[model samples]
Target: MSPTVHEIRNAIRAATGRFEREFEASFTKEELQAICEALKITVDGAGRPSTTRMRQQIRAQVGIAESLETADDSTFRKAELQAIADGIEASSDQ
Candidate 1:
């Protein structure tokens, strides 16, 4: 089975030094908000803070480069490929 989100979060946390505070990939909305407040990052004009925008801003402030993982789309099953395509199209429509 694929790893759970909590498992992924735990694995990332384990990779960091014992006392080091590297930003995590699986922060909840509340946890992310706390991080932003601690970092003194003000939100852009908005009703609610976007977790995605907050993550980008935090990564930028902390000098962490966001890396994109590339993979062969040909390796994915048709249903999986369709889901990915659907997600891309939906996001593009926004």
Candidate 2:
């Protein structure tokens, strides 16, 4: 049988309590509450009901996002891209 909504809610609350307890040990309770509130607000902002699809998208994006930081360690590629654009503009102007 599928879990009832109350069961899911209770499970979520229990998990949140455990998380808060761990965070509170390192940070103030107020900080932990604020962080949780911010996360809830972000999730609730989406008008559509969030489903497993949303979770999968977040996981996929996180995998790529984490790699972007050090994807190219050789040099500053943003600067290189800008220089290439500038060279093209200069060539077009001549």
Model 1 stretches astray by more than 4 angstroms: 1-25, 66-94
lDDT of 1 by residue, 36-62 (tens): 564567877666577777666555444
lDDT per residue, candidate 2, 34-84, as tens digits? 323323423334454334333322222333224333333232133332232
TM-score of each: 0.41, 0.23
Top model by TM-score, which number? Answer: 1
Which ranges in model 2 have alpha carbons more than 4 Å from their true place?
Answer: 18-94
> In model 2, where is the ten-residue run with the lowest total lDDT?
85-94
Evaluated at residue 85, the lDDT of candidate 1 is: 28
Q: Clashing pairs in model 2?
A: none
How far is 6's C-alpha from truth in model 1 (Å)?
8.0
